[model samples]
Target chain A: MITTDLVPPRKGSTMQFGIFSVSDITRDPTTDHTPSEAERIKAAVAIATKAEEVGLDVFAIGEHHNPPFFSSAPTTLLAYIAAQTKNLVLSTATTLITTNDPVRIAEEYAMLQHLAGGRMDLMLGRGNTAPVYPWFGQDIRQSLPLGLENYNLLHRLWREDVVDWEGKFRTPLQGFTSTPRPLDDVPPFVWHGSIRTPEIAEQAAYYGDGFFANHIFWPKEHFMRLIRFYRQRYAHYGHGTEDQAIVGLGGQAFIAKNSQDAYTQFRPYFNEAPVYGHGPRLEDFAEQTPLSVGSPQEVIDKTLTFREHFGDYQRQLWLIDHAGLPLGTVLDQLELLGGEVVPVLRKEMAARRKAGVPDAPTHASRVKDKYGDAEPRQPRPNANRGDNVTGGSPYQDTDEGVRASLPEL
Target chain B: MSDTAPGPAPVRRELRLAVVSAGASDPSSTRMLADRTVAAAGRLAAAEGITLRVDVVELRELAQEITTAMTSQFLGEGLNAAVETLRTADGIVASTPVYKAGPSGLFSAFFQILDNDLLIAKPVVLAATAGTARHALVVDEQMRPVFAYLRTMTMPTSLFASTEDWTDPALSKRIERAARELVLQMDSGFERRVREESWGSYQHSFGSAGGTETGIELDSDLMRLAAGGQA
Candidate 1:
C-alpha cells in the first residue's frame, strides 16, 4: 500500500520567483504627507532593482491609467530597469489587450526585447475598469472577442514571417511584420492571466501558453478549479500530460516573526487598498484567501501546498507592494521573502518536482535551435559592379606603373 | 449692423481628423500608413465640400512628456488638452508597428494613461507596419480591441503592411484603397450627422421625459466580473 510518508520533500525547484509592485503616488501616513509621482516612479525602479539584488528571479510592474497610480507603461519601466540591472527577467503585472491595439503592442515589446536582451514576458488581460472603454473610444461589449482576436493576431505576429488576417473588430492585414527583431530571435513567452474566466484558461491551454492564476483575493479551491480546467484542456490539445502543461500563479502575503505581528503591521494597509479595501476581515482573508500572514515558514508551507493543487507549474509572482505600504515596510517584506521564504520554498519545490517536471519557460528554451548556431548569412558578392558598389577602387593600386594589379591574373 | 456687413452665417461644419503615429521616425511605416490614411480623409472631405483640419501628432516626440504628464497635475493639464482634441475629432487614424507579439508598450502606455471617457463614439482607423509579412494580424489582435474598449467606432478595414509591402507599389495601392474605404465610412457618418441636424428641432421638442429612450447603459457589474475573470 502507498504510504503518505513516502512522499518526497519539496526542494530544488527552479521557480521563476517574482515580486510585483503597483506604483501609485500616495502619501506616507506615518511621517511624510505625500510623495511626488516622479519619486514614486523612481521608487518603483529602485524596488525592482532591489528585488534583483536580493536574488528574486523576476520583477513585474503593473499598468494603470488613472491619477495616483504612476506606472501606466509597465514595459517602458521594464526597459529602464533592464538597463540598470542584469539577470532579473522583466515582466508586466498586466497588459490590457482589450484597450490597446495589437500592432503597437507588438512593436513596443519587440523594442523592449532588444533593450532588455530578451529577458521580457507579458501577462495579457482585459483591464479592470469600464470607464476606460469610452476614454479609448471602445465598447466594452466586445471585450472577449477583442481579447481572442487580438491575441490570435499577436501570436501570428511573433511566430510567423508574414501574416494575413481579417477580423470583425479590426481592419484586415495583407502581409505585415513587426520590426526590431527580438534578441536571440525568440519572442517573449506569454502568460495568459485570469481569475474567474475559464475562457482565458481555455485560451491558454488551447495555444499551449502558460496560464497564470493571480490568486490575490480568491480561495484556493476557486483557483484549483480554474487550473484544473486549464490542465485538462492542455492535455486535450495534445501538448503534454496534464502535469506537463505550464502554469503560473500570483500570490500575496505579509509575514512577521509571529502571526500577531504580521496582522498588526499589514492591517492598516489592507484597509486602505484601493482594490481590496472594505470587503473582508484581515484574519478571515488570511484564512480564506491566498494572503498568508505569519512567519517565513508559514509562507513557504502555504506556497508549497500550491503544487498539491496545480502540480509542477512554471512561475509564481507575488505582490509585495499594495495598499500604499511605505517603502521601508515593503522592503522589509521583500527581505523576508527573498532571504528566508523563497530559499525554503525553492528547496521544497525542487525536491517535490524530482521527475517528469517541465522546466519553467525561458528565453534560451524558446529560441529556435537551428538558428541559434548559424552565423548571419553574408550578402553575395555583387556581379554588376566591376569594382566596389560605392564607386571606390576594387583593388589596391600597386607601386609599379606597369599595371601590377594584373600580375596575379 | 452696417447694411454692407451681412449677419454672420452659421459656422460651416468642419471635420477634424487627428492622425496619431505611434511610430519612431518621421517616415516610419506607421507614420507613412497614418499619412496615407489622413490623405484619404482629406480627399473625402474635399469631395464632401467640408473643411478638414488634419493634425498629425507623432507619438515618439510626445511619449516622454505624456508619461510625465500622467503623474504631475500641471503636466496632466497639457495631456488632457491633447486628449480633448482626440475626443472632439470627427475621425482618427492611429498607426503603429508591432514590436513583440503585441502592440508597442509605448503605444499601450499612452492608452493606459488616458481617461476611459475620452474616445467615446469617435471613429478610429487602425493601421500597422511591420518588418516581415508576419504580425499582420496585430492590427486586429492588439489594437482593434483596444479601440473597441474605448467605445470608438473603429473602421472595419485595417491596413497592415510589411517591409515588402512598403516597397511594393501594389501593396501601396491596397493601403490606399483601405484608407479610402475608411474615409468613405467617416464621410457617411458626417452625412448622417447632417441629416440628424435637419430633424433635430422636432426630435428635441419631445424630451426624455416623454419617453424612456435612455442613452447607452453599460453593464458595470458584467465588466467587473469580466475583469476579475481576465485578471
Candidate 2:
C-alpha cells in the first residue's frame, strides 16, 4: 500500500512555468550542420535535465512519427528525465489519441508513473498528419469519433479495475485489467490539447480535465474564442466556475540580454523556422502571434499579457529549443529564463491571479485527493487461478460488487 | 424624376457587397468589369431603395500576404481583413483576368484559402476578362465549380469579356443581368436568413467563419460522443 507520506506538499503558487520541445533535428542555419538522431536525442535529455537544474517546474516533449522530428517515443524520454529530477513534472506536449491503441497507453503510462514515482501527466491530441494515421492503421476521416471513444476507454481502464469495452475503432476487450495499475491507484491527470477543435475542448470539459490551447500559430482572437467556449462548457458540466477550469497555453520565445542582439541572432533561424519558414516577416509574426524574440524583459512582458487574454491559466509552456539552435544557445536560454524571466513572471502572475483558482494538477495532489490521509490501495494479485481466463476476485482487496460482476471464461 | 416632400425617410435596407478583383495592372479590364457590375448592382439596389456597403478586396494588393498565408497559415492583417469582408458580405463580385487558359493563380489561391463555411449560401457573380474569347469558358467551367464547392449561390448570368467583347454592347447587357440577379438574391436576405436559422446544420470547424462559429451544439453527435456516449 502507498502511504500519504509519499505525496509531496501542495505547491505555494497556483501557476506552473516550463518549456516544451518538439524534438526536431534540424540543420543549424548558421553552421549548416545537422545533428545526428543520437545526438539530438541526447541533447533533448540534457535540455530536460537543465530545465530541472534551472528550477522550472514542468518539462514536456512532443510526439511525431515522421522525419525531422525525434520525439516519436515521448514516454521513454520522459521516464528517463523523470529518473534524473525530483520536482519537475514530466509530460508529453501531446500524445496522439487517434492512432495508438488506448489499451497500450493505459499500460505504458501506468508503468511510466510507477517508474517515475508518480511525477507524470499527459496531454492528448488528434495528430494532423494524414499519413501517420494510415501507418498506425487508423482512418483520419474518423479522427474525431476515434479520439473521443479511445479516451473514454482509456479513462475507464485507469479508474476501473476491470474493463469490458467495445468501440468502433478497435476490437472489443473483455476482462482486461491494465497491468501495473496506476501508481497508488491514482490516474495521472490528462490535458486535452487542441488548436481549433471545439469538440476536443468539449471532451476535456466533460471529464473535468484540463484544456491546453496550441496558442502559438494563429491569432489570439481565435484562441480566445475557443478557450471561452471551453470555459463555458466546463461550467455547464458542473466541473467548476469558468475561472476554475484548468487551462494551459503554448508560446515560444528567444531571449538575449538586449533586444537588438536577440533579434539579430534569431532572425536567420526564424526565417527558416519549420512549418512557417520564409513566410511572414519576423516583426509581423511577433506582433501577431505569441512568438516573442527579444530581451528577457520583453519575453516576460509578452508572456504576462497571456493572463489578460486567457484569464488565469494554470500552466504556461514555451517552445524555446526548436529551430535548430545550438545546444549551448538553448542552455543559455534556460539560464536567462530560470534566472531572470520566470522568477519575476511567477511573482507577477501570482500577484495578478484571482482567488480560489486551482493550481496545476500533479500526481501527488491527485493521490492526496483520492486517499486523503488514508493509505492508497496497492493491489496484490490472488494466488494464480489455474488458467488466467476465469475472473473471480483478482486482487485480495477487490470490492465484493466488482468481484461479483466479473465475467467467467 | 420629381422631388416630393420628404416626410419620415424610408428605412433603406443595408446590404454588404464585396468586390474581389484579381487585375494586376492599373488599366486592367478585370477591374473595369467588376466596377461596371458593381455600379449596375448599385442602380438596381437604388431602384429597390436599398444601400450597398461596398468592400473591395484587390487581390493584387494582397498578393504577398496571400502567399504568406498559404505557406505559413498565418493570416496577416490585410488577409484577415479580407476574410472578414468575405465572411460578412451579402453578395460578391469575383472578377479575375484569365492567365494562359485559366483564371489567375492569385484569384484561385485567394478563394481556396478561405474557410469553406465563410461563403455558404452567399450569392456571387462570376466574371472573367481574357485576351481572347477562346478563354471565355474559364469563368463558367473553372471558377464556378470552386464557388460551387464552397456552396455559394452563383448567379446564372456569368460575365466574360475579351478585348473585342469589351467593345461590344452585349458585354454591358450581360453585366447588367448579372447585377440584377445579385441584387435580387441579396434583397431576399437569403444568406443572412440561412446563416441565422440553419447554420448549425452545416459543418463548421472550430473558430471558422472568422471566429464567428463559436456556438457549441450540445446535441451534436460528436458532442454526445465527447461526453462518453456511444458512437
Candidate 3:
C-alpha cells in the first residue's frame, strides 16, 4: 500500500473515463433507418476500437438475453475487442450474476482476462428482464438470492485454487477448480452496479468491491445518499476511509462544437429510444440527472458537480451510443469525448480528489498491490486429468494434493 | 372562547389525512366525492378533539410524472413530494372514477408507484363515483382489494356515489359512516403505534431497487442458500 500524495497508489488508472453501451439495436426515428443486427454488432466493435484510438480509458458493453439488444455473449465480444486494442481497458456495464452459473462465469471471464493480458475488469448486476429468468432455468422470485449466492461463489472460485462451495441457486461443488486461473494470480476488478438497491451497495461494501451507480436515468440526489451510505458501510467493514471507498458513476451526454446542434441531434433519439424514450422531455431529464447535451465545457461543468455531490469518485462512464444515431455519429461523439471532455475531467478530478482515494483499479495495479514486486503466481496443473469434475485440487498450487484424489479415482 | 376564557388551553394533535382523487376534469365528480369524504372525516376528527390536515394528490396533475416514474423507475421531485405526503398520513381517503369495469387508469397508476408497504396498517376510506348504480359495487370489489394488497385497514363501509346517489340522502350518511371508521382507527393509533414501535419491520423500496415491500417477509430458507455461511 505505497502511495504519493498527488497520484493514486496505482499507476495508469488514477481514474477512468469511458463509454458503456446498452447495445441497443434501435431504429433511427428521425432518419427512419435501422441497422441490421450484423451491422449493429460490427458498429459495437468499431465503437470500442474508436474509443482506444481517441485515447479513452475504458470500453464497456452490456449483456442482454433478448432482442433489441445484441450483446448476449460479452466475454466473447470483449475478447475480440481485446485482441484489436492495446491499452484500452475493456469491461462490462454488467455481466448478469443472477442467471448464469457462477462456475461458468468464473471460468469464462478468467479465460478472457488471461487472453487480454490483464487489461479487463467487469461489473455484476441482476438483470432487469423478468421473463429471461425462466429462460435461463431460474425463478424471478429468487433473483435477490441468486445474485448474492452466485457472486459469493464466484468470489471464492478465483482466489481459492480449490473451491468447496454449496449454494441454493446452483449444484454443490465439493472440490472444484475453475480453469485458466485469473491472470497473474489476480482476479479482474469487480464493481457492483445498481440503480437504487442499498443491499447491493451493502454487498459491494461488504466485499470491498467498487459500487457503481448507473446515474444516467435517475436524479443525482437519489444516488448521492446511496453512495454516502456505501462509503459509510465500507468504513464500517474496515475497507478504508469513507473517502477511500472506490466508486464509479454512469452519465449520458451528447456534445457538439455548438450546444444547439447537440440538442437538436439528440432529441429524436431521446423521443423514441426504448429504455426511456417518450417519458420526460430532454431538458427536464438533463436538469434532474447527470445527462448533459451541450458543448464539452457544459459536460465538464456538469460532470465536475458529480465529485461535489458524491465525493472524488473513481470512474465516470457515459452512455453515448444507443438509440441508433448511426456509426458515423457515434464515432464523432467518441472524438469529442476523448479529445475534449476526458482531458479536462482527468485533470479536474485529480485536483479535486484528496489523498488516499484508491484508483478505479486495473489488472496490473491489482497484481502489484497483491504481490508488490514479488513474482506473480501462475497456477500449474499436475496433469491433464479429468478429475477436476469429481473432487480435489486440479491446480498444482493448492495444498489439496494435486491429482492425488484423481489417481485413486 | 378565544383562549383568554379557558383556564388552560387544550393542545390540538394534528392528524394528517391524505386525499387521493383520480378525477381527470377540473369540476370532476370523483374529486367532489373525495372532498366530501375529507370534509366528513375532518368534522368527525374535530369533534373528537383532533385537528385534521388534508393533503390532496390529484392523479390528473401527475399523469406525466407517473409516466416518467414508470420509465425512469424513480419518482421526480413533484411525484416524490406527493408520495411522501401519503407516507406520513395517519389515514387515507381514496376516490376514483369507475372506468370500463374497474378503477380509472390514473388511479391505479398512482398507487402502482407507491412502495407496497407504504400504507401498511393505515386505515383507508375507499370511494368511487360512476354514471350508473350498477358500478356501485366497484368500490368494494375493486378498490377494497387494492388497499388490502397494501395491507391497509380498508373500512367495511366503502362509499360508492353514482350520479343519482349524489342527491339521494343515503350516500351522505354512507360517507359519514366511512369517515367515522377511519377516524376511530386513527384515534386508536394502530398505524401510529406500529410505525413508532416497529418501523424497522416495514420494508422499503430502496432496500432493493424497486423491489416490492408488500409486507411479505422476504427472508427465508433462500437466505441461507444464497449467501451460504455468510447469511
TM-score of every prediction relative to native = 0.57, 0.94, 0.88
CAPRI band for model 3: acceptable
Candidate 3 local lDDT, A41-81, one digit each (tens): 99999999999988888899999999989999999999999
Q: Which residue pairs in candidate 3 collide?
A: none
lDDT for A270 (candidate 2): 91
Give the Cα-based TM-score of candidate 2 against the true structure.
0.94
Candidate 3: TM-score of chain A is 0.94
Q: How many clashes show up in model 1?
A: 60
Residue A224 accuracy (lDDT) in model 1: 80
lDDT score of residue B215 within candidate 1: 21
Interface RMSD of 3: 4.5
- lDDT score at residue A42, model 2, on the 0-100 scale: 93
**Which candidate has the highest TM-score of all?**
2
Best candidate per lDDT, number?
A: 2
Kindly list the per-residue Cα lDDT of model 1 for residues B93-182, writing each as its tens digit.
888888986777778777766655455556788888888777989998889889887667787787888888867787667666766666
List, residue by residue over B4-68, the lDDT tens digit for candidate 3. 11112243777888888899898799989988887888778777777777788888888899988
Q: Mind giving the per-residue lDDT tens digits that candidate 2 earns over A1-409?
A: 1111222222424788889988899999999989999999999999999988887888999889999999998889999899888888888889999999999999889999999888888999999999999999999999999999999999998998777788888988777788878999999899999988888999999999999997999989888988998999899999999999999999998999999999899998999988988999998999999998898889888998899999999998999988889899999999988777887777777778999889888887787878899999999877766786436456777764664344554
- For every model in order, the fraction of real contacts preserved is 0.00, 0.95, 0.32
Model 1 chain A weakest 10-residue run by lDDT: A390-399
